[model samples]
Target chain A: MFEIFGIPSNALFGQLLIGLINGSFYALLSLGLAVIFGMLNIINFSHGAQYMMGAFAAYLMLKYSGLGYWPALIIAPLLVGITGVIVERLFLQWLYKLDHLYGLLLTFGLALIIEGVARNQLGSAGLPYVVPDELRGGQNLGFMFLPNYRAWVIVASLTICIATWFIIERTRLGAYLRAATENPALVRAFGINVPRIITLTYGFGVALAAFAGVMAAPIYNVSPQMGSELIIVVFAVVVIGGMGSILGAIVTGFGLGVVEGLTKVFFPEASNTVIFVIMAIVLLVRPAGLFGRRA
Target chain B: MEQRVAEPIATPEVQPTVWRTQSATILFVVMVVGLIVAPFFTYPLFLMQAMCFALFACAFNLLIGYVGLLSFGHALYFGWASYLSAYSAKAWGFTPELAILTGTATGAVLGLLAGSLAIRRQGIYFAMITLALAQMMFFFALQAKFTGGEDGIQAVPRGHLFGLIDLSKEMNMYIVVLVIFLAGFLFIYRIIHSPFGEVLKAIRENETRAISLGYKTDRYKLVAFVLSATLAGAAGGTKAIVLQLASLTDVNWPMSGEVVLMTLVGGLGTIFGPVLGSFIILVMQYKLAAVGEWVLVIQGVIFVACVLLFRRGIVGELANKLKIRL
Candidate 1:
């Protein structure tokens, strides 16, 4: 019965929870994008399609193989990551030496093909993905009722994101990645197989997207079009964060997601466009983005 | 490395030989003649649609080819202009000519706004910013009252041109659309050949060098952006009148992608490439209508193929092989 700013506190907290959850996906996806872009200099326009594939992979696994959610989480990303590896070997490898825009175009083509195939097989109408039985219940947090699945999504994504950050920013392997990103020739001179590393880095970035996708399947409808819908907003997030620092991408993703949730509370009409509006404003003020170094 | 080798082949031939000029003139004459007689054999509406898309693709090419800036959200100008022209013709009862002008003006204004912000970034960031802004505009059109939400503005009247010739007839409408397309196409050609266009090309080639030459490169890019947007709007307005409807499909991201595809398939920088590209794509879409969603998959395949094997595009490759400035 308590109210804050003329709206129920429960509603506000609930929206914030939803926003946080959405932000988790944004962080995970953008993290993947930033990591790939750092090493490959390509924006991975198919990131969205890959995310959609992860969800669908889970859906198909459940439908055909009777795989449960727990196992699908591990298997779906592996499957999607292998697909990413094939895509890199077949199409994207040729584009590495070309203008970076070519990579964007190539990936965009991949996205269109993937989405079209999915749409052909499964219509546009969304298919429901049931929350796992263990995560079905909710917790009374006094201020708001938190669904266990939502809590798990937030916690699990944050853990994955942080672990990714630590691996890239704090470990020996991370140093190799940073070194390769900065000077691949130098890294190759050090007897590291940079091309192989590049290929694996791309696959890993794609796996991150798939991981987020599997997490999202339970929350959102498992639909072919879901990734495209979210990817543009994530692109805006990337622009706002400036594809520079890994931590920057993660922070910006979560921040913007919360802001979007707040907008739904105060001005619902602008919810769809608020991120873009912020991107325009950011471009006007700091063209390099909040955490990005000047290009 | 491959791109470096392909660059010399794809660059426009510097020496405008007599043979090249003669071929170009012959091509133009043939195109005009084809436009005049083809309507008799083919459906005028279909031809008109192709012409409109051709203009749109040309406008898009002006930015990507000449200015070296790829705008992924050109549908904002095209779709926004379509809506304005449709609304003016329907509600304000303006003449078709006036309505089209209004649409072009709207595009110019929107271009000024979007280009200023977009020009702040370079390369991939610029493309992404433009696309995000266009997505914002899409949301606006979706919620705005005048756009009529999902149904869009329907039955937009094709009023008399100059308040004289009736455009309700298919022949009259086709002529008006053709004339508009040709004028816009010629104007773009003139822009490319002008001193101003040379500066744009220079900036595209090397921004640092252009700035060192004391040229205000930003102003030049902005101007080119506005010009391209206005022409795109002209195409959109004409299509609105021809089709008698302005829908969300016009403003969506897919439409923007289609324009990019048309330019890429035809020839990114070639004068006549977009026209050919538009026709080929439209005909493909028409023929592939029965295949349902496979059309998208096919378009995707073409995109991949174009990027991988035919980077110079259909006409671009032919021009390179023949050593012509087509």
Candidate 2:
């Protein structure tokens, strides 16, 4: 019965929950992008496609191998990350010395290939993945009901994102990774395998995207288009956050998602474009992005 | 005379300037001759489609090739122009040329807005900004009233050009399209070959150096971006008039990617690359239209192959091999 700004509290909280869940995915994906760009210097245009693949991987695991969500979460990312490692070794390794745009172009091509192959094999219709038996219900939070799976997504993505930040920013291996990102040759001189590290870093980024995909499968159907549109919005997020700061990416991701959710509550039409509008304003005010240092 | 666009990825052998310019002129003449001759043998509608795309690709080339700014969202200009042109011709009862002009003006204005924002960051950021902005427009078109949502604007009349010459006739339409394509092509050539274009190339080659040398590089880039958008607008408007429709396909991200593919396949910095690339791609699309996503996979393979094996593109390689600056 309560209202805020003439809108129902339930609708407001519902959209906010949706927004938070979406923001968590954005956080997870953008975190991966920042990590990859820091080490590899290329925007993984296929990150979205890889995310879709992860969802599909989960879908297929359930259909073919009788694997549940719990097992697919662990195995799908590993399977996709292994492919990421192979891609790094075979195709992406050659472009490290070239212009950064080449890396984007290459990955974009890879994305098209991956998505096209998937669409060719599977129709573009959404295929549902049932929520696990245990997490099927919702919890009442006084104002609104929250689905347990969505709560799990928010919690799991937040945990994964923080864990990634910690691993890259706090650990000794993280220090070496950052060192290698700064000066690969110097890092190599210290008896560390920098190329191997770069490969793993890329694999890890891919794995993060795959993990988000696994999380997304139950909510949004396992469709080929799951990643394509999401990736563009994520790109806008990257521009707003700027790839220079890892933490900036996470904050911007979550912050923009909440903003988008609020926009959906207040003005429905602009919801599709609010993030882009924000990007334009940010470009005018802070060209380097909110968290990014001057390029 | 400097080729900075594809130079970093692949080092092409440079030829003597005098011979390169002469042969390039010869090549231009040959293209004009071929354009004049091809309509008689080919389907006029398909030819017109190819011409519009060729112009679009060439306009795209002006940015990527000369300015070294790879705008990944060019479909915004191209698609918006088509929509406006179609709406005007169908709704406002404007003549074809006027509708096309309205489209061209839309492109210039949009370009000014997008270019100013995108030029703030160079390289990968520039590409992403343009793309994100374009996608924003795509969402707008999908929701806006006049665009008619997914069905788009259909049955747009091929109104008379300049309120006089009829364009409904196939040959009449072909000639008009030919003139527009040639004029746009020459306009781009003048832009790229002139002092303004040289400054653009200078900016592309090295922005910091250009800025330090007292050239306001952002202004130059913004100007080039506007010009490119204007030309792309003209092409899109022409396409709308010729095809008698404008749809979401024109405004979507794939259309933008298609333009990039055309320029990349033709040659990034080469003069005739986009023209060739557009024709080749249109032909491929025409043939492979039935196979579903195979075309996308093929296009993606081309993108990968071009980036990996031949960044210079077909025309680029030819220019390098023949020791001419195309």
Candidate 3:
């Protein structure tokens, strides 16, 4: 029953929780983007489409294959990641030597195709995605009631992001990836099979997005457009965080989400543009981004 | 491919002129004559729609073609201006010309802001930034009461032009649109040929080199952006008058994508590419409206094909084959 800033604590905490949940998604998606950018030197514009595919794949699995959320969580990412691999091999590999802009354009075209097909098949309406019975309810967390599904998303995304960081920063395979990113030719000289590694890295990044999509399906609507809108915000998050550092991406994603959530609670009119306002400020203050390395 | 870049010109050949120029001139003449004669064949409303989009694409081409900046958020200006003009004409009951001027000025200001913010980044970042900014505008349009929510500002009046010409008449409106397109097209042609346009190309080719050479590249970019945006607003304002309505569809991201597809299909960095692209795409859409999302898929395919094998575009490719810079 306590109040803060003339608003109930319960309402404030609830929005904060929602903000954190959204942040987890931002962190996960941006993290994937950074990893892919590190290796490919291309921003994957189809990331959102692949994410949509992830949710749709999960929806289809449940509808026909009789699989539950538990299995689809693993299966969806795998299928989508394989699709990424195929795309990389068939189309993206050709652009390695071209202008980075071409890569962006090609991926954009692919995204349009994927999204268009989904829209045609599914129509524009959102389909219901029920949370797993195990994760269905809420917990009274002293000051606020927290939805278990949302809590699971936050925890799971945080765990995945940290694990990815640890793997990249603290392991041998991570060392190879970091080294390859620094100099692929040099890495290949050491018998690292750089091209295959690059393909796999793309696949892994897409897989990360798919995982987030699967996680988001139950919370958000399973629709064709679910990712298209979300991806732009993630792009802004990447810009603010600086694609140069993974940890920076993770932190900025969560921080911005909380800022956005707090804005919704205090000044709902500016809630939609709060992140953009921050981005404009960031650009003015530090064009290189918060964590970008100055060339 | 690498060898093609290595081949040097032993002798500078005179740039050959081709039929594209003649054909384009002929087409322009035909289009003008057709517009003058269009009332007899097509509905005035349909011709107005085509002219509006054609002008929009032409304006859009100024930036992407000559300047090499692919702005994905131009729909923001187009949509915003449509709203402003619609509001001015309908709510305040201003003359059509005055309302259009108001919309154009709004577009110039928006262009100035967005261009300044977006020019900081280059290449893909630039595209993404513009896209994000446009999305921000979209959200603003959605929340703002003036846009009339989902319904948009309905029944916007086609007020008299200059308090003399009645734009409510189908024949009168067609002439206004045709004149506007001609003026806008000539204005773009003038800009491209001016020394200012040369600076834009230099900046596009190599910004650092241009900066090092002591050209104020950012100012030139801003000017180009403003011009492009203001013209797009003119197109949007004209559209509002023709349709007698303004809606959210004008400012949405898909509208943004639609313009990009137009420029790509017509030709990037070419004078008349967008005009050609706009007509081709509009005709296709009209025919395939019932094909559902396949239009999007087909558009995507064209985008990919253009970027990969047809980067020069229809006009650009023809110009290249004939050794002309048309």
Candidate with best lDDT:
2
Better of 1 and 2 by lDDT: 2
Clashes of 2: 0
Q: How does each model score on lDDT? A: 0.91, 0.92, 0.85
Clashes in model 1: which pairs?
A: none
Cα lDDT, model 1, residue B300: 94
Per-residue lDDT for B67-130 in model 1, tens only?
7888989999999999999999999999999999989998899999999999988888888888
lDDT of 3 by residue, B104-212 (tens): 8888899989888887766667777788888899899999988898999999888788899888887888888888888998888789889998898777667778999
Candidate with top DockQ is: 1
What are the DockQ scores of the candidates, in order?
Answer: 0.65, 0.61, 0.56
- TM-score, cand. 1 vs. native: 0.98
Residue A243 error for model 2, in Å?
1.1
Cα lDDT, model 3, residue B238: 81
Error of 2 at A262 (Å): 1.0
Q: Worst 10-residue stretch by lDDT in candidate 1 chain A?
A: A96-105
Query: Candidate 3 at residue B324, lDDT?
Result: 48
Q: Which stretches of model 2 miss by more than 4 angstroms?
A: B1-4, B8-21
User: What lDDT score is found at residue B102 in candidate 1?
Assistant: 88
- Candidate 2: the clashing residue pairs are none
